[model samples]
Target: MLANFHQEQSTKSTLVYLTLSIDVARELTHVHLERFLAPLQCLRRLELVIARDAKRQFLDAGQWENFITEYLPRLITFEFKFSSEWRIGQYKLDQFRSPFWLDKRWFIAYDSSRSCLFTVPYFVPTSIKHSFVPVSTNLTTLPIEQHMVFYDRVTELRLQEHLRSLPYRYNHVKTLIIDTSCTYQNIIDLSKVQSLTVDISTLSLSSLMTAIKRSMPCVNYLSLNGSYWELSYMSFTGISLEQVRVLCLSRYANYQGDNTDKWSRLFPHVERLIVSIVSKSQIPLLIDQFKNIVSGFFYIDPPYIEPHNNDPLYVDPSYIDQIHIDAYNQIQVTHEWLMEHVNRFRQSNMDNFTYQINEGDRLSLSLWIGEDDKTAQVVMNSYFKKNIVDSMRTVRSKTENLSSNTTTVITDTSTTTTSATVTTSTVTTSTSSSTSTISTITTTTTTATSTTASTTTSITTTTATTVTTTTTTSTTTTAPYCTTRVTFDDIPGQSSTSGVVPNGYKNLNWTNVLYLNSSTMPTSGYQTAVNSPPFVGYNPGGTIVQITTANGTKFAFNSVIVSSAWRDNLVWSIYGYRSGTNLVYAPFTMSVINQTKISCNACSNWDTIYFTSSGGTPRSGLTGNGTEFAFDDLCISFGY
Candidate 1:
């Protein structure tokens, strides 16, 4: 009975305290072990029983000493067996036995072969000092089958004895693998684990989603079985949006029903996804269905769609001869259909787009005004075949109709007499008549007479004037000219001495500009060049110049000047090139005002500086034109 009791406890919990030999003692001891222990202490429940013959239970002196050394002093239980002929002697009793004492623990022994029993109770007077056995710190990873019972007992013991004893909580577990039988609650409790793989058949959808929401906050790699979507909708109710990074889905068949919407909600933030399916066609549709949920989805399939005829043509009906062709074909069709739907959905969102097939099996598309160029390019680039019309191209014909109806208008109006030539819908009309020709014009419904001869009579005095007026109107309408306004501001430092010149004055001169010595110049005071200079001073290091107003409030130039020589450099010095074409220079003139210093100042702010002729002799080895600098500006507007 005790053996049966031990076996039952072990099978249920698998936590063993100690073994006993006698059946009666085992029974008595197992019943009282839990009751006598401290309220918070974990009772070591027995799991196995061994009934050996008395002769086989012989113990040497050294063995006895070792046992006494380890088990004495503590009020622990022990069972011993004796031979059938042996009798309890005084020496043996004195050396090995102790009477039942409350302060010390009790020991029970049983001999199954002889049916003899012995019990040694705790005796404080006979106790010897002994070292306490240290508990192990290492934890064994339990298999999925045994985790439930193991974790329960471990947790119970931890809660009772080790909860407050440890410095930190026991949440360091990193990897968890759940098989098909684990319950939803079992997964939820393992939220601290960082990497998890779940067998899809184990949990309902609702439970799975809940687990994901709970566990995904820390998990980096998540692998799901193909049928994961089969779980209930409620299971994914509180899924976390940002936690998942890499997701792997395997052995997935075609979706059973209208599960598109549910999938979108479940994996909204999945960045990298890997899926294995029966058919390649279903891949696109599945991708489209969840495209918004994941950043990238990789579809892996067996090499079923092989090139046929060496012409880059894929084999049709890839799974026709396969064992599960029907299932594969259905999946393939669904995939292809899903992709088509996605393309349609995308195209429906575009406008004024046209698609055309190009050579080399390429597709070319154009987007008219107001259409998104980038989106069109993406759709065009993503097309696999030239003949396939992308979503953006479906409405191309609609754009054609609106574009065809457009008409260009040309209107002609004149002063002598208002003659209007209207061109609309591809037709041009010119109607001209003048009242001046008929000064005393009169009209009768049936007859008309003129005062002059028949040839000239048609042209009455007023008619003559009208004819002239009509001719003048026709000449004016044939050629029309109009003017638009143009304005120019005086470039800085180019103003006249008086600051105001007469309106009709054609020649403008600018003088008296001061050159300042400074490394950095303000950008606001000067009218800088609109672009980079035409001549870069060095192959690598280019010169940049800036002009600052007198008050240093404004500046403009091809680029910001950082060198001190910027103020002293000749305005016509070709510092750089603009657009690899036009020559650019500083608009200043350098003159030696004193023996030790020189002044470089803008010749004219109203116009760019140009040197027709430098009066000084040419520098050594330099000849011709004496560095004649010429730029287009207003101050140099007059020339001989």
Candidate 2:
């Protein structure tokens, strides 16, 4: 069964996390477990929940220890809950209390009544379904005794109709799924809850709103799963969930005509929406209603097709010759419909904004409302590259035309587009130089284009005209202003965890930032931000960092290469100061893995500089907004 369940023949995938919840009905053996885990050599974390098993061999810690040591050496975190039918004293628990687990602080707990042995803290489920009885006994090999708190790992909790009174505290629960009444305020900490899923079939919307207002103040992601007809009749006039930014509606709910206004009034600050619509026409109404929506996932119903009418009992003549709509055709129609509707709305309402639509399991539309200077810079570079490619293609076509003896008048002009400007003037030049000497021209003459003859003529006249030209002949040399470039590679302890940039080392006082070797600690941010061999400087926290001369000497801040540490579109701001006065300020946005050059040429003779980061979207497959940034190749000058 395990072999058939995972049919992937290749084991070359870098699978990092694996979770197995198996029942002992199939009788899992040690060989089966080894074969199942053999392909996952790169697994970093593993969680298992085995139920109703009398297999004493599965609970042997020494076997697990040896298996992990030999086969899964890359495994850093392991959690499991093995429930057996064995009696309280049937198996010895001392095998679990070993140096291998104790040194790593991986504690375990046993519930003799339930016959469950599980890892402490790590094995605690995130989402629990009602009446959770806390574990009583914890066994460990450590000398120092410590209190074990299990609810720290619980992020989502589902409650029953009747809540039980328990003397327990939960501070980390972020999601609360409730169906009916609850006395949870006394035991559970709803202050930290950000998501609330209410089964309104059993509970009243008004009562839920009252509870949200009283308890769940931080709730921003709300999911209402219940009957659509019942919810429509209920009035939500006075209730306004302004804090909700992400709203997920029940798939069973109908969102046809007037329902748009109902949901719009309820969630006014909704930026991310997950919804279900009955027809494609409702998409425009949704976009019109939710003006604040930046991105959305829409579950659209596929078009229904009529079956072939070959039976004698066919009821309606209208269904006799109906066109069949296949999945491919339906998807194409959907794509075209989205482009037509969404682009029309964007042109009228959001002219300056850009949006992208994709078709998959769900129709996703993400809009870029307002971008920072850094994001703009990245977009501009791509746009420039595209234009260059297009211009080359155009030039190639023109060259082909010239070779074919066709009269092609190509005129380059100075004009400005939306974000870029182009200026062109045709020029003709001749260069002649020797090995020992070189010639320079200060001024050059211009000429007009000669008139062309008839089209039948085989002569292909190609003229390069100069509108304005200037040349100079002089010899002057100057010393380089930027004599030193700090690359962070010369710092001692290159492979250490972290090292601070000393005051006198680079004649600068670095504050609130540290340099770390990416090779030693290959974290997500450091791996992408490292430009040099091993070292890169960064401030993990979004604090106001500073760089100042130790002896109060002034320097010119030229430029530096910077990258986002853990996010995309990260805005990094740098302010140059001289004698407590702000001289120059520059702010730019950056994406992870892309090192951007930020020029601070205007900043000169500054005694100090302040750096701060703010506002960035999380990188792909990562959680939370990262306001941290990494920087290297700082070019500064003391010549000022």
Candidate 3:
């Protein structure tokens, strides 16, 4: 049966536990026992409850020892239950005699109800010493139940030795909490912790403060609970309040009345101050005391008072302009109050103004008249269309055409109709001595003829005078000439050249001769000089002078050469003007290349000059009113 059971169990993958009857166990011999235990090989954790009757004969001390030594070694956890009649205590003692029984690989829990406490050996290996040593430097979150007994004793000499030997070290510890009682030694050890929370009695305040100063020199958040505030003034006298950036002083009533001044000094670095007030009148006192340091003050009012009170006796939030007070849900009034304070500070022209408002209130902005008010209004209207009004309407002018009578006069040999379309003040006359046709097209027409010779004359004369006269009367449309403004940088000069000359100008030859010199150039105001021998008048815009070599090669001056001794000292200038009655001269500087040549191809109606200095000062030869001269050997292109 045991062999069959083993075969069935081996065939199944599922873990199965069977509690066999004592009668069935007695029927199994040693050979059957091996088969019965064969199915137990696959068990993860096996619990064997030995029946009292089965142990009487089949399972003796020797048999149980043999099974345990050979079969139970592969199980992860083994629990053995002995019956009351089984004399197995002596055998168990012999099993534990082996050194492996004392190893910490397995956790052994015996039935203490049946066994004597003195006789049962509880094994604890020396390797458990690792539990007392520090493994990590960060102590933010630790299992309190596991380390609760060591909190007070953590600073003992032996534990400190173990901590010092830890491989990991911490320079700054954050968010350290000590729930159990702490000794002075423990506080000293925690002096390096930056943020700390502790539940300690009043007696531990000194140690806590000392640890705070040493461990967390710049603690931003400090939450202290328990009866630590009950300490007398003398006991808390040495505490440093400057390092506390945030202090949550819960249960403030427990602090003696005498300690209010001390508590007030603790928040020197606090910018956002949050405090609960028991009475409404205490709010004013709190504000008055810390107004200098606090920029944003939030007060949580007690629920007893009716927040909305129209009575004049009630506290008016307007009185405290800088601070935003919660008086029901009216945010507009608070916004206006904030703006009033901002305007007042702006008016004072202070370097640093404290802007204090409610913690969650959005700042209010205002608009007033300024230089940019018109621009601001346009922008505001674009964003908020309904708030703005258009105040001005556009106006335009109407155009009118006046009709007038016009008469035109034409004196010619041919008879033709004259039209009056001339709209200028000047009269134009076209005289034709020979047979010619004269015609005028305009709005009005008139015709008249005059004969100078008789028709009977037989002389063969090719000249015949035909006088045809027509009058054109019209209104003048020309306006008076206005003098044009001139500037210094508008001087006309020359143009740049590419190496590849054009086809018609490719055969031209040019020289770097002195085209302009300080001697002949204008110094100041406009003047004209006559063209002399060896010097020709070359129109920069029209015809160019061409020079040909003895070898029949045609050459043109590509640039002009100017010589000025005072070139660097003098600011040379050039200009051009319309040569008529209302002359308008625009003076400009001519850019001189190689201290001489000006690209003549680029110049347009330009006259050059050399100034002794800028701002109307003229140079001599270099410094005079003005002078002009004709250019010599100037080049022009004509050949192939």
Candidate 4:
């Protein structure tokens, strides 16, 4: 019987490893089968496993037939054991007297105490052959945990064979859910997968990018859920963005750093960008930074009032619904501004510019790559509408419809007869329950009353107070005034190897912003202040500040002032619209104010100007003996 069982098990697998001796198998009989399998609910759930045998220790065909045809029952699968090895003669004792395997060999013991699967050994298969039965649960994205029905899916693993076997777990998985424990190797081979969600709260951006480079060749969509501040900076060296196109980045409220550069660096070619904007105030800054994006999805979070610098306290969430509505309205205004000024971005020259918007998250004002502005507004406002009108309407109607309504409920116990009453009037809270009526029960028994000798009564009353408030919102627009500041940070990236800015006055410190010429560039990149240095600015050596808008529109302004010295024979000329028409000022007559502020008197309502030495001609008002012509900060005053 022992040889027959071993032979049958051997036929079930390519390799058979035996832990039991021949004597033990021989001692097992039909009478002992139940005792050995007493913990199993049914024989079908038993795994028909055979140990791996690479050392040529398998049984013959004749024994294989005898053992299978006689003792074995119907089984679902063959569980190939992860045993050490099979030696030809390791069992010194008689084969029939071998010890039984210690793990889940023939039975799965149930634990009625906890109503769940008990802890099993690592070597033991927690799930038997019957565990892989196909059911009609129809679940798409399964979240795996350690206990309950949770099962480890595509996560950290040691061997390559385990990775190859993942297809058996799920027939076709398009999306994967991996937690912090997942490594680059674990998900590097999911070839068919198309979308990936990374929780950067735990994993580093470098590790995630490495995995993406190694594995996600076909994946084009990605969503990152974490703080943008965590991504202080990113340099894309090995990351492949040839296929990736869409990204939904949800930076939490606490994130401070700008994610524009990070996103531009890591996924340079991403076409559709979605971001979680905590408040409407960040809209202008976010818009000013990121450019050339095809679509935008701005998910507006609940409004958080900007607390003062030193104030520390927690605020409850019981504020009125109007507060929430105002936040949404602010976002609406920002969205409108974006749509109106969207053409401003196209000024840099685009092919066939058009517009469309859509909802991003269910409540988020996301911009999908599609059309129809009406649909976008509907989707964006859906959440606020539901919460404000439809969802709360039922509760409000219950309280406001009736001036006063009363009902009661009654319960009775044989041991005691008690009476209870409850009354509700005019004022009411926004709370709700199913109970509407209350009744009192009195059992009139002289003998019962005599034995108890007690009287019981209860009374309850609810009073509701209603407070009404009205809020009005107003907005005002004012024209911009004149102000001058210097920081050489603009665009058109370059230098002539001499570290000289265009036209030779400043140096490009890797930033386009204006940085005043100091003869040597500072590493900090922001050392330009008009308040500093021999009156701060530039003679441009020969180059001039030729102002023009990117859209070919006239750069109209009321007054033009140049930071130049007011000295004899040191005069700067100006050219532009004079009194709403294009004109140029002769170098000699230009007004130099206060020896520090040079005024372009003739170039009023100017559209353009070139601050130069007026063809080197000596010209000025009453001034000093020294001749010095230098220009620094340029201020343009515009008003309606």
Top lDDT model? 2
User: What is the per-residue lDDT of model 2 for residues 1-640, given as tens digits with 9 covering 90 to 100?
Assistant: 5654457546534676677788763477766877778767877567777877747767778888899888887675577788887644424567666777754445666766567777754444456666454554434321221221444445678877565655345655777887666666766888778878777565666667767867877888787766533445256657777778777664422322366767788778887665654434455667668778655544432232222234222223232123222333222223334446764444654344433323332222223333222120001111222232222221101011112212221111111112111113423321211000001111111111111111111111122234445642322232234556777888754435566665565788776566766664343455555556567787634334578888777887655666666676565666667786655544455666554555432245778877666555676653223356777767678746
In candidate 3, what residue range of length 10 has the lowest lDDT sum? 448-457
Highest TM-score among the candidates is held by which one?
2
Model 3 Cα displacement at 152 (Å)?
16
Report, for all candidates in order, the number of backbone clashes.
Answer: 48, 3, 29, 37
Q: Root-mean-square deviation of each candidate, in angstroms?
A: 41.8, 21.8, 45.5, 41.6
Estimate TM-scores for all models.
Answer: 0.25, 0.40, 0.25, 0.30
| Model 3 spans > 4 angstroms off | 1-173, 178-181, 199-207, 214-218, 226-238, 253-260, 280-640
Model 1, span 94-118: residue lDDT tens: 3333333111222222322244333
The residue ranges of model 2 lying beyond 4 angstroms of the native Cα positions read 1-55, 58-107, 111-116, 126-129, 136-148, 179-183, 229-235, 255-257, 301-328, 331-640
Identify the superior model by lDDT, candidate 2 or candidate 3: 2
Model 1's C-alpha root-mean-square deviation from the true structure amounts to 41.8
Displacement of the residue 354 alpha carbon in candidate 3, Å:
11
lDDT (C-alpha) at residue 209 in model 1 = 57
Model 3 Cα shift for residue 212 (angstroms) = 2.8
lDDT assessment of candidate 3? 0.30
Quote model 2's TM-score.
0.40
lDDT values, one for every candidate: 0.28, 0.54, 0.30, 0.33
